[model samples]
Each structure stands twice: as structure tokens, then as C-alpha cells.
Target chain A: MSETEALESMVGGEYKYGFTTDVEYEDFPTGINEDIIREISRRKDEPEWVLEFRLEAFEKWKQMEEPDWPNVEYEKPDFENIQYYSSPKKKDGKKAESLDDVDPQILETYEKLGIPLQEQKQLQGIAVDAVFDSESIFTTFKEKLAEAGVIFCSISEAIQDHPEIVKEYLGSVVPKGDNFYAALNSAVFSDGSFVYVPEDTVCPMELSTYFRINNMQSGQFERTLIICEDNSHVSYLEGCTAPQYQDNQLHAAVVELVALEDAEIKYSTIQNWYSGDEKGQGGIFNFVTKRGHCRGDNSKISWTQVETGSAITWKYPSVIMQGDNSVGEFYSVAVTNQRQQADTGTKMIHVGKNTKSTIISKGISAGESNNSYRGLVKISPRADGAQNYSVCDSMLIGQTCGAHTFPYIESANPTAKVEHEASTSRVGEEQIFYLQQRGMDEDDAISLIVNGFAKEVLQELPMEFAVEADKLLGIKLEGSVG
Target chain B: MLEIKDLHVCVEEDPSEEILKGVNLTINKGEIHAIMGPNGSGKSTLSKVVAGHEAYEVTQGDILYNGESILELEADERAHLGIFLAFQYPVEVPGVTNKNLLRQAYNTIAEEQGREELDPLQFEDHAREQLELVDMKEEFLERSVNAGFSGGEKKRNEIFQMAVLQPKLAFLDETDSGLDIDALKIVANGINELSGEDNATVLVTHYQRILDYVQPDHVHVMIDGKIAKSGDKDLAIKLEEKGYDWLSKDASVL
Candidate 1:
């Protein structure tokens, strides 16, 4: 066979998580409006104030236009043809009380994804909140978290059980009108994980949320919020996967984090949504808005993500250093392959004196895909003695793929220092041959090279997530060499 | 142990431009042979072709290993079949530690031969023994494969890998090109330690200086694409004294 043919065969491994679950579920009718928002709020049993917040966000969303500045091309999604909300029906109006109470098919799906939902079958020292479609199917280790004064539950559950805390910090960091997607997520978002660590407390376990979009026609709009109180610490992980479908699915998520004085929040995500087939016929269009606010002195917020899926991804998880001596960090590795396009990086806005921020991003493009790292660093005049460092690197696997870097730095204070570095490289054929001659096959060689290129960012991920991200990257670049 | 029959090869991009024209050679167990030639005499091409490099097309040739044709095999397949090529310029693979690369290569060959694979601890112990053969520090195993290594260090690493792999038919392609006297001695010592009567070694070099440490049983002078003269090690000293111009003229007259 020709070299190109061999590469194609290597990368054409079928998506293992493409099977759909046969579950009795309900979904809203196609399209978005105030009535749909009200129906969603009513179904969730949200309080009046929460409904008012959604309505206010909806009004603002109607006036906002979708941003077109991203370095990606696709037929714009017809929002009117999408179902805004979907949920699996509860058994006899009761939530699953135990593993036996859950639907066998739904449990089987998670098991197939290698995520064991049953407490006895789970990995120790970690709590899992499994969000399927528009609702949290189950949350494990809740009682243990509650003992430590940590609130780990679904957003809808938080709103119902701890309305005062929820109302105080819901949109404080990322306001409703933050962006077009943020506003839309604010209006129609269903279920996502919520965590609250109390003052002077360190969460005993790693909190994670596994999100699966199972409904074929529904768009997943999840709202996640994490709050670390003064002198508190928490590490949160998120993993998402979707079944394969011909029609594009929309996933517009809003994740907001708040770190108070002396608090630290580590947020990591491994996003493995369906990236369509080799021809790019169907996949998810992931438009997400994530931000963190260092609201008190000496607080730190770090965002680490390994993105390997989605046909067109447009997201920049940012940090706002609003307190003196605060620190913010962003580490990302984005892999785009087989007609995928990703325009992603991070934003660091320094607002207080002596603030610091660091950004490291790695983008890998293969098989006609385009990957871009677009980042911004802004230091305000009041941010005296602020320092910022940013490095963006791109790796191209094949001749047809393209990689780009766009960095914007703005400093109003002479005392503030900012440094930016960018580099672009291709997977050289000689490198592959060298490894091949060492007895490793072509695919193994590519995986090693690509992983090494992204090691700086991959190492930032949690232990288990690092392994998963490595495998996902390997799968995404399969058959990418020519 | 290895034989090349009427080998005619060319650049894969333009197969008409033959690099190796009807070249024939044979080496048996317990023999060490040196193919010394001038620049662009197809010495490197012959070594690469024997290792199954894909950039060259063997239009009319057959490479036999243990009496079976190996022309159709991939480079890694040839590697698994006990064919080792110590590259002239070793590629630097950053982020892959020398230890990991050696372990993978060792285990791959072992698995192919149906030998039990060594665990990490066992392999580490085994690799350290080979590291001593090249006089490399223990820390060299922790560094990336050849990345940031000096030219001499890279040559030492090539020999280190050869010691660990223990190939039956080893090809040292210009392994002495960029080495100081100290490094050259170390590399030659490692090669000497690895070579035995049970295996054969082929040294492709442009100079005969390396033969002082690891003597060869036979020396062949290559001009254009074929061997022009075959003799004992005295041929290397003669070529070194008279230069390759006389050999080229003699081959042309013949």
C-alpha cells in the first residue's frame, strides 16, 4: 500500500464511545424562546429568582450576535432547529437511590466508557457526578464531602438546597452578558457539577464530573460553578464524551470559578466529544466560556485542559487577577485532526498590584485540520509590578494541516512586565524513520513525538486524566502522517 | 549470515538514478568486514538499504538474512529480525528517555523472538550493564534519546544501543566520523565487546582510522557503486596512504 493509504488506515479507528443508549427520555421541542426557558426552569423546580435570572439572560442573548472572529469555518448552526433541553425520565418520579435503582442501560453506557458509577467499582479517593444530557444521574461521595463542609452536587440541586449561597455567587465571576455563548448558556443551561469548599478546609478527595450528551437532537448547555472560600483548596476534574451522529450537535457550556483570599482552585478538563468522521460530516460544535476570578489577596486559579475532539472548538478559559499578590495559570493542549478546527488559548487580565500570570498552550494539527492558539494578556495601570509569561507552540503532523498563533499583549503600566514566545514545527519524516528503525511502528512513533511535544501541558493534568488525554491524542492523530 | 546479490538501487523519487549498481557482497559468522570508500561512493546507501530504509528503491536486488530474502521487510521488521544499524547521525527524540527507548527496542526484539520480556527493574539492571560498555554515566539513561548530546556522545549512544540489542548482523554506518580520540576508543571498545564468533559486523566508514581498535577480517575499496578491490586489512592502510583516486582509476580501467 501507499504511504498515504497506510496512514489513513491507522487513523481510521472507529470511535469506541459512539454507541447510543436506549433510555426513556424527554426533550424540549426544537428552538429557543422565553417559554422554553420558563418551561426548563419549571421542570427543574427552580426558585422564582433563578427563573428571573434566566429570563434576564435570555433577553440579553436575543440582542447579542454570534461571534464570527474565530479562525474556523463551518455552516453556522441553526439554533432554531435545536432542542434546548433533554433529560432521561426518572423512575416513578423518584431519583435513583442506589446502583440497583439506576437504569441498567445507562449504567452499562458509563461502564463501557470505563467509568464505573457504582461506589464499590469506582476508583478510590475520588467523587463522581455523572451528568447525562440535561440532568445529573447520580452523585457519589456526597455524604463524605458534606462531612468536610464541601458542597458537591448538581447545579440544579444546589439551587434548590442552598439557594442563598448559589444566589450570592452564581454570576458574580462570569456575568450573564459575558459573551454570546455565555449568555445563551445562562438562559437555557441545564445540569452541570457544582462544588463549594468552605473556609480553611481542604477537600479530602478529587471531585469530578463526567458529562455525556446522549440525546441525538438536543444541544447540551451545561452551567458549572466552583467556589473556593478563603483559605480553602480544591481540585476539580471534568470529562465529557458524546455518541457519534451525522448531524452536528451544539455544546455551549459556561464554567465559572471563584477563589477567595488564600484559596486555590485547580480545574482540569479532558474533552473528548465526537469530532465527526474523517470527512467531517457530523460532530459537535463546542463553544464554551470559562473564567475564574481571584477575588481576594493571594488567591490562585489554574485552568488545564486537554481538548482532542469537536469539529470546531472556540473557547478561552481566562483568569482575572483582582486581588493583590494573586496568581493565575493556564495550561492547554489542543489536538485537531481530520477536518477539525480549534481556535483556543487563554486570557490573563491583571488588575491588582503585584499580580502574576502564566500561560502555556500547545496545539497539534493533522489531516487537513487547522489549530490556532490565540491568547491575550492585559495588565491594568493599577497592576503595578505585575508580571505575565506566555508561550504558545504548534505542531503540524501532515503537509495538509495548518497551525497558527495569535498573541495580544496590552500593558498600561511601565512596571508591569510581559513576555510572549511562540513556535511552529512539523512532525519531520526523518524523526519518524529514526524511531521506526529503533523497532517502534509508525503509529507508536507519532504518538511518542506528539506527546513529547505537548508534554509541558499534559504534565499539568491530573494523573488519571493525563493518561486519558495521551490516549485521546493518539487516537485523534491516527493516520495523520503522510 | 548475510548476503547481497547483484543489488541495484536508486532514489525512490527518481528510480532511474541508481545509487547502488549491481553490488554484491557476503559475510559469514565470526567475520568482521569493512567497506571503505570516498564521499558519495554509495557506502551509506548500501548500509541504509540493508536496514530497509524506505527512501531508496531496490529495483533489482535481493538482501538475504539467514537464507531468506528480506528485501520486502520494513525497517522495524528488519530490526526485529536481528539487523541493527548504528546511524551516522542519530536522530534526537526529545522527551523519550534513553532508558525507555532502549527498553522498548529490547523488549520488541525479545517478543518477536518469543523470548521472555524483562520487567522494568530487570531491564534497568540489564541496561546499566550495557551503559558501562560505552562508559556512559547512569544519568545518560535519564536523558532524552540523543537530544542535546554531543556528536561523540551520540556515537557512544549508538554503540550503547548495539550492545544492548545484541544483533546478529550489525551495521556500523560511519560511526567513527565525528569522534575525538577518547570517544573513538570508547566506541570501538563497545563494538569489540559486542562482536563475537556467533555474530557478524559490517563497518561502513570513509576512513581506516577506526580499524586500529577493532580490526576487520576483510577490507573492500568501493568506487562509484561497486567494490573495486578486496583484500585483507592491508588494503585499508594502502587506501589510507595512496588515497581513493588510484582505486577509482583502476576501477575505471577495469
Candidate 2:
């Protein structure tokens, strides 16, 4: 998108990327229960053990309560009112004739959303990951991945086709009874991508749950699993910059990653869910739990997210360094505008000797929104020579918005080292004037300043994601300030 | 190229306290003018007002660039018409490379003038060429805009930007205030090199040190928010010897 388009969107306080893809869909009835979970598992034709896993998770969820500690105010989402599963109609004679019969409208929408033509063709699953890697160069890409023993497919497909790998790593990083939302996801989650990079191999294609769900009507409980074996590498992306209509007001997704010795997994997310109207009447409530485990020495896992939407967001994509010399990183840029509330950060748990972690977060709040960076860095007593560094910076646009930073750090090991730095800056009139005097208009000046403020976190994004994220920030904050 | 007709200005925060009280000045192309004044005498205020700083309100009169009144333009609009003000204190823009802003300003002005914009590689070469004009190192272009820069380095950066933008009417506000002798020479050389027949340079200063390096065609001393006296380059030399006390009395009488 052009800078002027970004400026115009910010001035109007409107979501810039919203389009619909017309397709036949079959959805489960609204509400949550053991029967609904059984029906969802039965519909997917999951294996008996997979159904048992869901049944156990459902019992665990029955004993749990919704979390209330997040620094956000919103009406509790009625679990009974949300449909447990929905997808494009999948049955005999309901499927399209040929694999090349991909919808053109989806490609048009992707182009309008700034996806390159090549990417549109290459990464065209266009569903909540239904029949992902289905056609086109997808065959070649899959062949390339198969040549390296990389298993990439929908989680349901993975559970049926690659049961051994799924059984070994599923819920290993984030357990079924870990939290309120995660337990709910484990019980009745719909479709999400599953990736497995074999030992001593590098995945040839970037994996993503692009448009994770096609008709995300009632709610989305997507559970994603990724496992990187020894000496393996994989880069996974989630979500997209396109603004989703999101008729469903709730989204609870779970993502878990496991990295073995010398393995590295880089995961990035660009969340641009609907953030309601100017008055904050309706929007998506995004509650997700994402965590990664460095299971062996010299392994690494990094989480980079650009969160610019959702009326109320509560997520902490974190990492647990369990192996000596393992590394973890969290780079995030969370922006909230127009009465939106975002309470998001990361947690780094250094458990083994010589583990290291780094956290850099930038928060921008505008239009009376509330944005907070709440993070924790815990170096256990046995983590000798463990190190952690964190920097959380906040920027306020208008007078009514708020930006907060809450960093909880603990270094129980005497030899561990930890450093934290925080700063809060407002986009003052003087700084605007300085840029304007150099020939940039007001919107351009604000865009430049915001980009400068978020540069460190943005540089951590992948190439295409970085470009889109920069444009997204420009669209969100350019004209929000005077 | 610039004409200030009985200009009166006040801070928008305090509109009752006029800072520039009926100031009059006319600058022509190829001429270098020096405005020397004491503390709170409105020399800096005049530069800021001409650059259309929103914090300052022009209470009366008008400013004309190339004989067209520009009182209605915003700072960036006036800037597109080739008016530049090098601030006494350049604001720090952390994480934004100096080259980024310079190329943006350069391309914008080029497009405004109906000239083709340079691509990134071409612009990088063009930007590096201007660094030599300010006697600045190549690394300066890679650093954040004036963030953590020394005072002298910041002043040189202002001139470096002036060279890149190539404004028609440039206001150097205290551009030489905090420089040592060696740094002052470098800044003076930069100012002298950029000054040409097509553009006018207005140097706002407190002392005669910079004027000795880059001679001015006219010198004016401001007192109590008005230009109290106007003369040739010798006027700056005279003020350096006698200070503004002698001129403050004459300005009050006028």
C-alpha cells in the first residue's frame, strides 16, 4: 500500500484491508460440550487416541475457569454461544473438479492486500488450512520438503497420517491443562498447520496458516504444533496483514514449538484482526498462548510479532530455555488505537547453565487506547552464567492514550546477569515541526517518527512481513497524532 | 528573495507578548545577511516565524518569498517553495538514519521543482557528495538523525542538510554558536561553499567570529524584538567591539 493510503486510513480510523471470499461452508452449531467435541473429532475422522486426547482435555476444561487477571476490561465470551468448528464444505461431490480450480477472487483479495503475485500462487491454500499444500508449484514444494523428510500439512491430517510424530510432540510445550484458553483450544480446536523438520534438514518452504480459517464465523480455536529435530531449521509465519471481518468476536488459538539440539525455529506473526468501530462497540477478543521449548543444548527459538488490531488482546508468546547454551528471543511491536486494549509481552525462562535470552518490545497507543508491555525473565538457581537483556519502549500519540511497561525479572543464580531498560516518549509538536520543516507533511512526519521508534523490533521481521508491518504502522498511527 | 514587511510575531502560548515587534528586512539573491542580537531580541524568533513554526503566531504584517505572500502556508509547504531554517537545536530522531530524511527531502523538493527523483543508489552517491561539503565523515549518513551527536556535529549536520536540499532562502539560526575555532572554520567553509547567486543566506548569530570567515553583504542588529540598526559588514565588527548596550538605547528611542 502507498503512504497516502495509510494516511487516509488513519485519518478515517478505518480498517484498510477487508474483503470477502465467497465459498460454501458447513459449520457446527453454536455452544461447547462433550458432545460437540465428540462430533468435531468424529467429523474429522480422527484416530481413537486423538479423540481420547480431546476427551481428556474437555474434562480438564470443565474444571477450569476463565482467566480474569489480564489488564483488559471486556464482557466474558460465552463459550456456549460460539460454534466449535467451521470449514468449507468437505464431502463427496462437494469438492471442486480440479486442483487448478482455485478461486480467482481470493487471488484478487490477496493482491489488494499487497501479496505478490508469485506468493499468491505459491501460498494459496486459502482456507483454515484445509488441504494445505494442495496444488500448483505446491507439488514441487512438497516434493522438495519430502526430499528432506519435512512433514507439512494440516494438524488433522498430521494426527491421522503422522500419528507418531504428533503423539510425541503435541502438547509437549504447552500442555492441555496449561491455562483456560489453551485447555478450551485443546478440547474443541478447529484446523491449524502442523510442521515437522527432520534431523539435519532445512525446510525448503516457509510454512504459515495463511488466513488460518476461511469462514471464522463463530470463533476460532486453532491449535498449531511445530517440531524441529536435531540440526534442523524451520521458519514459520502466522496470520496476515489483511484486516479480517471476524464476525466471530472471540479467537483463542494455541501454538507450541519444540527445538532439539542445534535446531532453530523462527516464528513470526502479523495479527491484524478487526479492532471494532471508533466507539469500541464490537471487535475481536484475541486470547492465545504460544510457547517454545529449547529441548537440547545449542538450540534456539525466536518469536517476532506485529500486533496492530483486536479490541482486546492477551497473549504472551514465550520461551523456556531448558538446555545449556540455548538461546531465546522475543521481538514485538504492539499498537492499539481507537479504544483498543492490548496487554501482551513475552516470558523467558532460563533453566539450564549458560542459557541466554533477549526481549525487545515497542508499544504505540493512540485514540484513548491502552497498551501495556508485561514481561517476565526468570533465571533459575541452577542457570549459572545465564544472561537476559530486555528493553521496553513506549510511545503515546494523542493525549488520552496510555502506554505502560511492567517488567518482572529474577536472577536466582549468583552468576546470572540481567539488564533492563525502559523509556516512554510522546510524539511532541516540536518533533513533528522538526520533520515538517524538512519538507515532510504532518502524516509523513508522524509515520517517520513511529517507524524510527519501532525500528529495532521491526528489523527482526522477515522481509515481506517487515514491509507489510511498516505500512501497517504507517496506516495505524500516521494521522492519529496532530 | 525574501522580504519581511513590518513583521510582528508572538508565541502562540502567550500571544500578548509580541516577540518580533514590527521588524522589516529585505533579502535579495546572491546576498549574505547577518542578523546579530542579544538574548531575547527576537533574532531566532524571526527565523522560526519565517519557517512557519506552528508554536509562533504572526500577529501582524506578512512574509513574502519571491514577491508572493506565504503567510498561509504550513512549514512543509513553505519548505517545498525552497525556504529552510536550520534550527539552533536540531531534534534527535533516533533509529531514523540521516540519509533517509535527506533523501526524502531531496526527492520531495526535486518532484516539486518538476525534476526527476534519484533512485536509492544514485541518491546515496549524491548524499555522500554533500557530506564532504560539511567536512563530516561518511559514517554521519549512517547514524540516526542528530541522535547523540555533539553540538558541533549537529550544526554541521544542519549545513549538510542545507546542501542536500539546496533551498533558495536559507536561515542559519545560531549555526555557529557552540563551535570551537577549528569546527567553526569547517562550518564556515560549508556555508560559504553552498552560498551562490541563485540562493540567499541569512546568518543569525551573536558574535562576529563566523562573519570573519564568511563575509556578509549586510549586517543588522536586533534589540527589544526589532531591528535597531542596519549597516554593511563593518556594523558586525562595530557591534563586536561595543556590544548591544549602545544599540539598545538607540532602538528604544526609535
Candidate 3:
């Protein structure tokens, strides 16, 4: 169209955060050390014990080098130079009454992204936690959810109001030293969603978080914790998008979930961060660590994600089945267009008897993008008669794109049954011709095919988020198909 | 409305082995033509070439639709010009429902002709009406495109699409290959109903049984990629009675 306007002037065309916001921030100067970790904990007004946890995590992070195992390549981030604590000027203290009370400019960013922020904007039964920049702006349907005795609010507020519950479950699933990015997240995580469903309570609404990175220079480090008590059930959805910029921004996040006896949790994510231009400059370096611990018998946890953005993505939402009769599942559709690269999959570690897990991954590679699925299913001797099934399929759009799958399965229990299936296919020219011959244009044909390929994973999303995810996938494959 | 001149095409993967060797044919409006030949005699190749299939290299052919050279047009462009082909083996696309697909196809062609797209409700009504013409069940529209469909059901769905598309020049590529007697009659009847005063059809079949129901306007015996004999409808009866071996032996004289 017209000459590429400043990221601030853009309205929409797939990348909703193609606009920048005029905002100032109070942030930590680049570099990571014990002092920086303490400063972050102090800035959040956390207890001394929490500060110790951050310092210990910083030490562990220093002992470990940056992971080079992923199929992505990027210059090592100078941790000391990066601002770890960045928040809006003085409005950080102002609590939003509802989505309307949130900054008009911030609301405009979400509107440009087409995310529904009002009560009527929500479909059927999805309750939203809208996180703007480094803080949770407003959470809807909280009063109705209080009737069910479920505590769903911002992590920062949870720490302030429900410190005991937060202290009991925080890091219980994902330890501070889980990974390099996780440790980094523990040291400087700003704010994310906190969810808790009490025993025997079925949450009344689908809990959701819509993360908007408004500031161009801000690095979003959000830490989320979810806990489901015995016989409790909840479904949580997360959607994230960032403003477009010329310099690559970093987003390191950690999400942990704990499901006790007979509890179930379903976590869904539609990640559509601005993936930069075709030449691959100025995108987000998304390194996230998400894990769930099934600590109760017959408990279950499922993670489903549709990733169509980020220039370099290093993520593996995994599950640790530590209780007998627990179940874990991971369904994902990761699409890499242009010069993007993603190395994602899942890990299912069976530590208890009769546990089971399933992983289904579909990767679509277009343009010069590289997509990979790396997974592991480990069954310990104590996990008697454990079972695991993993299916990973990759669809390549063009010859220049690449798709790869790596499965590492280790079983100490002779009775365990673990099977894996993987296939690499190029969406056949015949398939497109068949659709076009039926009168569909080439773009429509490709979108139909890709949607069909990703239907299994898309079905796992909440109804409201699923529609947005489907449209986002369609838009992401625009120029890459032809 | 359809014309093929000195059509010489070869498999793109193997250029030395020619598929269609200088075949020539012209089909006018309102005519139902039957193309019968033995397997590997380029019966399918000729149909694919006319529909602008990309696999076969049309090295020396010129396909014209209404006096315009269509050899350079894309498959979709050819479709916009009222060319439709019922694939011998329908593709199974999971998560894409038949109703959604038909509506998209119908509206795309309509838009290409400078017509407004049918609204969602209108499309459903039109698709439901078209499905009934092929004796298809209403449930077929809700199913994934050919996913888990039976042989007969898939064949009927193809005809259902034909009825909905209403192309001026339709190519039924062995549409009765795996159809049972009942399905064969239903498909044939669907085709016959869709063939009208301004449109035509090219029935590509190996068996003469389908001819018993649809009754072609002209029957052409294909031998070695060329139409060996072109005659009236009775020629199909002759071929059915005497078998293609007789034509193969006599056509060698040419």
C-alpha cells in the first residue's frame, strides 16, 4: 500500500501491534547480578524470603550458559544492559475499575489487535484478564467467579492480598532453577495472571489473559502461576501481541501450573507477537518456560498453543506427572513464516505408577522459516505400566522452508508403552489445484488447507480465542503461500 | 465452446514419454460428448489438459475457450470461464466442511463474473437445493470434505458439486468408475439434469453402462491419444456390443 508508515500510525493488517505508544518507563539498567535481582524483588515490595529466592535463581542462571540447542540463532542478550523492571510512569499505582478505565491509548492498542475487552466482547463464557505492558489492567467477571470461591486476579494483587496462597503454590510446579530463561524470569518477572480454583469447584468462566506490549523499548517478562486444588477444574487462555519496532525486543516469560488430586487444568495460548518484516529484523526473541506438575492422583493438565509469530522462538510447554494416575497432554500448531524460526514441543515426565501422556504437534513452515519439534517422554522405574503417545506432523509451504522433528524417549520401566509418529509433507500442489478448480482463489485455497491442517489444535482453544486464532493464522500465511 | 488443436503434451516428470500426442477435438455448446478408450490411451490426460492441470507439459497444444487461447490460463481462470472437472479421486480435506467449500466455490466463481456473493443463508439454501438434485443426504454438507466418505457417497458428492457449479463446459472424469448401479444412475441423472440449452458436458468413461442412463449426443472412440472414430449415439452401442478390441483393431489402419 502506501509507504510503510511509522509503527505508530498503523491500524491493522495481521500485525495489530504495528503501532507504537508514547510512554516513559522506570526500568533497571542493563546487567544481571545478585544486586539487580534484589533490586527487582525490592521494587515489587516482596518479602526477604522472595529476594533470597531471586538471588539463588540468579546464581543458578550464572552457572548455566545460554542454551544453543534450539534451531534459532540470535546474539546473546547482554543481561546487564537490559532494563529488567519497566512500568508505566505514575499510573502504576492507579488500579483500573474495568477495561474502560484502562488508559484510552492502551485500550486502542487492544482494539487495534481486535481483542475483545468488554463484557459483551466476551463469547459464551470466557472471562478475561487484560494485562497491559507490565501489569494486569483489569480482570472481568471476578465477582461472579467469587461465588465459586475461585481466586482469579493479577499476580501482583494476589501477592498483596492472598500472600499465603501465593507462597504455597508459587514455584511449586516450576522451580526457580528450571531453565536459563525461567531463572531470568524469576529474577525480574513483572506481573502476570494468578489463578486458583478451590477444591471440588468447577470454575464458572474460562479464565483468559490478553497481554499487550505497548512500549517499543520495553522487554516483557511476565510470570504466571496457576493452582487447582483437589477435584477442581479450570480452563485458562492466554493471548499476546507486541508493538512493532526496528530493534529486536525480548520477551522472557514463565508460567507454572499445579494440579492436585483429581484436579484438571487446560491452558491454551495464541501467540502472535510482531514477527518483524520479511527480512527478519526487529522481531521478538521469545524464550519462555512453561510447566505443569500433576501432584495429585488422577489429576490432568493440558497445554495447547498456536504460535505464528516471533522471529526466534525457544519454548517447550511441558508437564511433570508426579502423582499416580495423572495425565498430561500437549497439542500445538506452530507456523513460522518469513525469516522466523521456532524450536518448540513438549516434555512429559512420568514419575508415578500408571500415568499417561499425549503430545500432538503440527508445524507449518513457509518462506525461509525453520520449524522444529523437540520432545521427550521419560518413564521412570517407579512409573509402572506408564503410557505415552506422541504424533508430530510438519507441513512445508515452499521449498525454501524447513521442518524437523526430534523425539527423545527414555523408559526405565519395562512395562511402559511409548510410541511416536512423525511425518513431513509439503501441501500438495494438487490439493491447491483441487480447491482452485472449484472456484476458490489461490489465497483462499491455501488458507483452507492450512486451517484444516491445524484444526485439531485449534479446537483446543476457547471459543472466543479460537476465532481470533483462526483469523490470525489466515492472515499470517498471506504472502508466504504464493 | 471448447476446442483442442494438435494437442501434444507429455508428463512433466518424464518428457520423453508423451501422454497426449497431437489429439484434436472440438465440443460445441449444448452437446454431451462421450470419450471412451482403453486405459493409458490418454483419456484422462486429455481431460486434465483442458482443465489446465500443471503436471502435464502442454508442449505443442492450444486449448481455446470461446475463441480465446486458454493454454496460458491458470486452472482457476479456466474454471472462471465455466470449465469444471469431477476428479476421479476426490481429495479428503479434514476440518473443511462440504457446505463451506461449496459456498466458497460458488461465490468465487460468481464474483469473478461480476456478480455479488450469496449471503451465508442464501448459500446454505442454494447448496441444500443442489445436494438434493444428486440424491445426496443433508448430512453430507456437514461432513468434512470427503473425509470418511464411502465410494458411492464421494461420487455422488462430485455430481452434487457439478449441479451446484453449473459450468458451461463440464468434464466428468470416469465419474462412474466406482459407483454402484444406484449411484451410477443418480450421478448420471444429476449430470443430465444440469446439462441445459447453453451448457455442455464431456463424459469420460471406460464402461458403456453409464451411457445407458445419460445417453451421449456423440460417442468418440479414442485409440492411442487420437479420436479414432466419431459417430452418433449408436456408435456407443456398437462399441458396447463388439467391445473396444474391435475398434482398436480397425483404428490401427489409420
Top TM-score prediction, candidate number? 1
Task: Give the TM-score (vs. native) of candidate 1.
Answer: 0.96
After superposition, which runs of candidate 3 have C-alpha atoms over 4 Å from their true positions? A1-13, A91-103, A116-125, A141-144, B4-24, B37-42, B55-73, B110-143, B147-156, B177-198, B206-209, B221-228, B234-254
User: Sorted on lDDT, highest at the top, how do the candidates line up?
Assistant: 1, 3, 2
In angstroms, how far off is B95's CA in candidate 3? 3.5
Cα deviation of B205, candidate 2, in Å: 1.3
**B1-254 in candidate 2: lDDT tens per residue?**
78999999988999899999999999999999999999899999999999999999988999999899999999999999999999999999998999998898889878888888999999999889998888888999999999999999999999999999989999999999999999999999999999999999999998899998999999999998888999999899899899889998886676
lDDT of 2 at A81: 76
Model 2's CAPRI class?
A: high
Indicate the DockQ of the complex predicted as candidate 2. 0.81
iRMS for all predictions? Answer: 1.1, 0.6, 1.0
Which ten-residue region of model 3 chain A has the weakest summed lDDT?
A1-10
Estimate, for each residue in A330-416, the C-alpha lDDT of model 3 and write its tens digit: 999999989999999999999999999999999999999999999999999899989999999999997899999989999999999
Cα lDDT tens digits, model 1, A158-212, are: 9988999899999888799888989999999899989999999999998988889
Tens digits of per-residue lDDT, candidate 1, B37-134, equal 99999999999999888899999979899999999898889988888999999998877788988898889889998889999999999999898999
Winner on TM-score between 1 and 3 is 1
DockQ of 3: 0.67
lDDT score for residue A476 of model 1:
68
lDDT of 2 by residue, A1-482 (tens): 44233222322335655445566666568788888889988887788888888889989999999878778888898788777776554436223333344455544554454442333344332112232111111121444567778877677767877999899988889999999989988998776778889899987666655542334455777778999999999987766332355343677889999999999999988787778777887678889999999999999999998888788889999999998999999999999988899999999999989999999999999998999999999999999999999999999998999988889998799999999999999988889988999999888888888989999988887654565466668777756875
Question: Candidate 1's C-alpha lDDT?
Answer: 0.88
**Which one wins by lDDT: 1 or 2?**
1
